[model samples]
Target chain A: MTRQALPPGTLDDTDRQLLNLLQEPLPLTAHPFAAAAAATGLAEDEAVARVARLREVGAITRFGPFLDAAAMGGAFCLCAMAVPPGRFDEVVTLVNAHPEVAHNYERQHRLNMWFVLACERPEGIARTAARIGKETGLKVHLFPKLKEFFIGFRVVA
Target chain B: MKLDATDRRLLAATASGLPLTLRPFAEVGTWLGLPEAEVIARFAALQAAGIVRRIAVAPNHYAVGMVANGMSVWDVADEAAEDLGARIGALGFVSHCYLRPRSLPDWPYNLFAMIHGTSRDEVEAKRQQVAAILGPALRASDILYSTRILKKTGMRLVEGG
Candidate 1:
């Protein structure tokens, strides 16, 4: 029989359970963690302490409301550039220098560098993409979404 | 749906993160010098408007054993794309599924889904699962594994209201 995969980091079963709960929307009340604490069989303070520790230990990156950029009247466009592997890092720095470049990733493909431009307005998308193209001396191919089938982000800890 | 000055301040004040306390909203209220009631009210309103997707832990995928992720793209029949994409998005392993326009010649994919797993093999397995779902409707497909995350700050509100 195959063995179960070990939980990552130093998280115990309780921590894992708490993480699973935390990934979903917390209560919008004054004592948001009260229900979570009760569910995890921990004191409210203890639950808060654990969450703070998780963040400090780098297990959880951020503990806040995930604001939808598009809902906020902002624009986001996916873009890609094919750069010579030799100059990848330099090109990455150039492309990522812009504040509008919200997320950038190096992927395995002919168009190796993939990034998302988050702009204050729809027009800003093209402008930021053009700037990156000019600086990197590469074609910035934009792939805006025609439609989205958003299946919420949830990971079992 | 429109954010007034107060809403902007609330968003900006807690952009980094919400305070972790029994009465965390009160703490955020303190930071912005607003009463706890106002902070709670604003958060409720923002969430109601769908601007705040969720207030929860943004776990590090790598730290949580979800180390492998791939942008799986496909060239699909335009007519079947919407129905098939919705099905793919419903799968637990698929986080983001979208229908995008093809660039042609250089790029021919019009559908994209981000698949995640604990390892590359698992990722590929999930990719196959997606393929099975697409069946004959899928003309071509490719999986782009992320080698590095150059930058990844989720959409932050930059301009002041």
Candidate 2:
């Protein structure tokens, strides 16, 4: 199922190394790229340029502080809805109308539609879910994570 | 750590991204009228409080050929959920692992691990690894393949300004 998107030589060894390395926690120092460069045996300028190029090519989505909304008195909730196939488009329109919805994906399941709601306050999750329910006339199941297991997660780049 | 007005300003400024420069922190500071040292200090403090998970890179799996993203959910025994969850999360291929509430008859999976691969078969293979890790504790499992993206407007800053 792997479709070769780029040429075989598109991503060099250094590029792959940086991609994997950058996934780990970055230093909080003023010159983070400088630190990264030193660790990866690259010049600071080159590291910056290569990262920028990766971003330009959409090989990476973002590189910055990953904030936990819950720590900032905010909340992120995973929500799902089993929308009828015929009303799927209309329901999506109504659900996506709320600014709280970060992203919505249609999945293969009876409870097909899944999305995440990032809210400033925890209460906002319930409020937005209720509003979406009323608007779409569908039951929205909120699966706010009860516990998150910290993983040594590394994206396959 | 409670976020003050200045902190919120800093967050809102860098929410989109941290400027990619030799002195990226200083560049972010310039936007919020803070010195580089103070910006660094505040971030350090916030990070200590677990507010900032990390400063890192996020690879777009889709763009990198790991386009097959599967939400492989497992119904593990409740008593052993947390223990098994930790094991599942530690897998190199598992991106996110969360122990969530099972919605009874409708849904019985409590352990959710996001598995990504170059193809669905690869994803399935990874899922099998997870199931194997789960072993007898795994009662049932299923994977939901995303059919489409209904919307992708990205996250927003809540109204507080």
Candidate 3:
């Protein structure tokens, strides 16, 4: 399907409702769409259509289950790097290719490049790093999350 | 998003972590002193209101062997940022990507993309690749490595007694 281009900052109430729903899905139930439609005061078809539209517009990145890797005995850490002026996209592409890499972001700092990699075990993290290094030819500074005080947040629009 | 009492109760129960069981909601309902159906209903409402983003597991990267992680910030040309941001978002390594209003005199970066790696060295290498793609148009960029994680929890939709 040809993707429709979204206008800048063009979001209606239904669009907002869709974005909000994608962030946190309700418990999977027999009538999930019906439940959501009731809550949003829209028809079930409208609720479903809104979500699909959001995905099409690129507003909602991914709508899926959030897993607790820690509970599954997986190891993860937050790391960052300082990239020169001219290689952000190339580096991002290389880093994103790794399966273990889960969450990546750009923050305000000298060590500008940052991402999180979650692996089956703690040892696998190092190997993933080495592979990324080999692929990109840049020194990756491994900053394992030493302590986790808190980890989840939601932005209400 | 204004949450009702039912919404509040549901959020309070599932905010930290989901019950790992076959009947998770039933278990959660028992803990919260509510009926399973009610808990389920409110949860659905909370999600629709945009109050509860997702009920999912937060992975421990360290435990999984992803020892290194970082927040990669970029200074892309204002004109090209939306396009570049979309491309970065599509990358698997990038979990979160957004365009924040640049903080003048404090933070100059307008676009941010996060990438995760097992080791710090690995993340650094990824950064170089991103830099190459950005080319000469980027004005400045930085990586704020997480020294400590203060708090991570779902928003409390209900008020206290």
Clashing pairs in 2: none
| iRMSD of prediction 2 | 2.9
Q: How do these models rank on TM-score, best leading?
A: 2, 1, 3
Lowest lDDT 10-mer window, candidate 2 chain A?
A1-10
User: How far off is residue A58 in model 3, in Å?
Assistant: 34
Residue A79 error for model 1, in Å? 0.6
Local accuracy of candidate 2 as per-residue lDDT tens digits, B1-161: 66788878887887878876788888888888889999999888888989788888888777677777889999999999999999988888888899988886788889899988888999999899888888998899999998888887776665463
TM-score of chain B of 1: 0.91
Q: Supply DockQ values for each candidate.
A: 0.53, 0.62, 0.05
Count of steric clashes across candidates, in order: 0, 0, 83
Off by over 4 Å in 1: A1-9, A86-90, A135-137
Candidate 3, superposed: residue stretches over 4 Å from native: A1-27, A30-157, B132-137, B147-161
**Which candidate leads the pack in lDDT?**
1
Model 2 DockQ class: medium
Predicted chain A of candidate 2: TM-score: 0.84
Looking at candidate 1 chain B, the ten consecutive residues that score lowest on lDDT are: B152-161
Residue B58 lDDT in candidate 1? 79
Q: Please estimate how well model 1 matches the true structure, expressed as its whole-model Cα lDDT.
A: 0.87
What would the C-alpha RMSD of candidate 1 be, to one decimal place? Answer: 3.6
The residue pairs in collision within model 1 are none
Which regions of candidate 2 are displaced past 4 Å?
A: A1-4, B159-161
